[model samples]
Target: MDCEKQTTEYKSLLKIRTGDKGFKDLSVTCVALANAQGGRIFIGYDDKKKAPLPEQHVTPDEVNEAVTKLRSLCFNVGLVASEICTDDTGSQYFIVSVSPSMHSVATTSDGRIYIRVADKCEPVRSEDLQRLGEEKGAYQWELVRTKYLLDGVALDALRQLANDIRKSSRVRQHVKQMDDVELAENYHLVDEGYLTNLGVLWLGTAKQRSSICYPATVQYIVYDVLERKVRKEEWHDNRLNPKELLLDIEQKAVELTYSYEFPNGLFRKQIRHYHPKLVRELLVNALAHKSYTISSDIMIKVFSDRLEISNPGGLPLGITKDNILHAKHRRNPNMIELLSALEMMEGEGSGYDLIYELNAMEAKNPPMIESSYNEVTVIQNAEIIDTELLPLLDFVLQNYQLTQKAFTAFGIIAREKKVFSTRLSAILQLQEEDRLRSYTDKLLKDNIIGRNGAKKGTQFFVNPQLIKNAKVNLKTTLKTVEPYVLRTLIMEDLRAHPKSKISEIGGRLPEIDLQELRKMIYSMVDVELITEGARTDRRYALK
Candidate 1:
């Protein structure tokens, strides 16, 4: 029986017999599926033909044996669901479903761990295994008990926290009624008479916290026009507490604004460079998720165009750069709990959703979270959102529930007025046209955008009706072709040729100045839109 040629979904297998090879193969596939979104593995069916194979039927006894062997091989794997079905021709088949694991990485008998990438199982590297261990909270430093006793906890910090909790609308009535010790205990900040690391970090005196949790402090820096640090500050003392630390950071943060007066002089509009709520949310997350075990301090760097906050530890277990918006895990659960109770943060795992929503509404680029083995850095761009299309963007976000990729794609179109499929694909970091087409299709289907030209020449633009409904003058809003529009033209040329020399590309786009073409090509290469070839070749291609 032929297996499915493509690795899109379900795995196909022949009849499972009484053999080690079959069991081993089944075990490996199970690990792969479990590491990813769970999928079905069919025994005694041909996935390529989408039919039951008469010769591939497995007996009831063999199915039971297979399940036993698979479970034994993948003992560490969480849930393995199985079922048997009979076709019209009385051909029986077994279907094993492997559910994704939340904590442990699944391993086969030989001790090799695997994760599903595309349609194949790839071995999990040592680095990835370490990261997986982190995601699972296998080493939660914040949960560890410290030598410091509860008596060392600051009374003033406790009183301030309780007061804030009482005033917060998010806190429950019972929580508001609880005393400091009761509240701390409820959140697992105390173990016996000793305060956990969380308690020390939250309530210890400035000198006590600095001595005990030295690395848990934050370092703030502001860079000048030349990128040299012009100012620096530290928050090692515990006198401020976490709540006051947030307040202090806000006070130190620079808030700049741009204003425009209406033609009639009746009103004015002002836009702030950064949002205070966003700053607070970022600071809270850093404090709540940093690895207290690490010796490095959390750092917040402010530049002219962006705000970057880096925590000592990487993303919490179960969260990846790609899945952070949809995934939630707590590296410092106790800290998160107390902060949430005090209404310092939104504990519903919707923090990123709101960040993205605010970015969309403002027409600003969404904040980017990058992770390494030792740290997670978040960069929030300060570019003002384009005011012309703000209404259209806000309308779409309010009315439609779109995927992150789709939302980003919409933003690109809104900002550029029109964008080529290739440029859009490049900007979205999507390698496949088919995958990008799915998102573009949604925009087209909803009539939020319209496609101009076709195939490689395809340009996505906001639907005129959408702009009209948004109450913008169509004539004033009409997109004018810019010099950067030539970038799309060049991308289209590369799509057909794959690789081309400057002269050849120049011949294709003769309207563009030779020097301008060179500048655009070099700029594209710098941004990784195009790859440079050898000196002899001196060619460019889409990457």
Candidate 2:
């Protein structure tokens, strides 16, 4: 077969070389790609296919010898190599198919290991190797032997976690009569007469935890909307246990979020004003699956509009961001189990799915998952649902059975004034009075909407508090104002008088309509520019 035809068959998997000697490097490259994801390497053609092909024949004996050497080098590390076919052309080419190993393979002799990243064979860094080892259940910390007992395993945090477990029926039934050691063993904290990395992370003293690779350390940062770097912090250093550390980090996340209050006649109800659950879930997931063998800590970054949680390690094997919701793999199963025992998670594999579902239900952006060489990050965007739309959604949800078509209709009605005929029919099918009332009840339960009046005379609108608390006007309420006109008026007045009264500002620009001026004033108010005074006189000042 022609080189071009072979290249087309293995576009992503194959890399071509011009000469016969390049086969030696190609062997290792094949191994690295296979170790990551099975791929093939082709020898005898240039990568760009511009160079002339070599006119040499590689004998079956030489091919066997090379394969033998490659296999021998990776034997101790548990990687296998296979020779699939050899071309009969005078310009010889061979195919080597490397399959995903049952175990993570490294250099057997331990000098230096390499993996193909984009198009180069880069040396696998020590941190990355350690992470791979941990992901493959071969973390060295799991084999460390404790020479001394420290303060009865620091049961304060453990006891609190146990109390939480007792409250969970799923965990309580499985934990009956199980002592701390038994529980630890069941959770894989200790393995075959040795304490694992997880044991040190959860129950070991600060000093003990430090002895392990990177046990339960976390970094927290808060940023303004522009990510100007407001606060930089680290947690779980040498003074706190996993439980205390996690709780502390969670509280910090809550503290860093933006909140607003809705006033109801005589009382004010406060809402977090940010998607707290999504943030918490992402952080918790990061901690649970982090590679403890890596020396870095989990990182939480809070920005004005979003929060990001990154852990030191890539996605676990068989778990990619594409299939994260459906894949059920955990790099740190023991840590996951313990958190589940403490009721922090539903179970080992359900957190990601729940986060996605909850975000969908709240009509917020789905959490974004990303993996780099040494880290996995989950980003959560904070979006506050429109206050007025909440009541309408509640009415629809309670009174009607939900379907994709009905959901689309409700979204249009809440956001746009008109719904398509088909969509309206779907929504009408779900719009029973009792169901609408139930939906309203749910909205009230979630504090997203409020209702007033009785029976047929009752009217529903967006909750007043939601309307007032949101930073931007709802889509339905946003009125377009001419920016050039507003800027010209403001600048011209500032240039003429240095400062101006609200009435004077309005009078100076008579072409600016009253409604447009009101909208501009409110926009300016949001950014703290123009100040409204007690009397009719309001002043615009630089602040």
The prediction achieving the highest TM-score against the true structure is 1
Worst 10 residues of 1 by lDDT: 256-265
Query: What are the per-residue Cα lDDT tens digits for candidate 1 across 165-231?
Result: 7898887898879988787777676677676767776777666676764446778898977889988
Task: Quote the RMSD, in angstroms, for model 2.
Answer: 16.7
Measured against the true structure, the TM-scores of the candidates, in listed sequence, are 0.59, 0.58
Candidate whose lDDT is highest = 1
Candidate 2 lDDT over 1-543, as tens digits, reads: 333321121221222223334434555565555445344555434456522255544456655655565565453333333443334344555555555443666443334466545445567776567655655566644445564342465455455555565676667576756766566667666655455666666666777777766677778888876779877777755677666777787676654566666654498745564556655567677777776667787888878777778888667654556557555776666666677777676575767655654544444545676765567888877664555454444455655465433343334344423222333233333333454443345444544444333553333334445445543344533212235557656666756765567667678776454544655665775364656464456666644
Stretches of candidate 2 off by over 4 Å are 1-19, 22-26, 37-113, 116-120, 125-128, 140-144, 150-163, 172-174, 190-195, 260-273, 384-543
Residue pair clashes in candidate 2: 388-462, 398-435, 398-439, 399-435, 399-436, 400-430
Overall lDDT per candidate, in order of appearance: 0.70, 0.56
- Model 1 Cα displacement at 178 (Å)? 2.4
**lDDT score for candidate 1 against the true structure:** 0.70
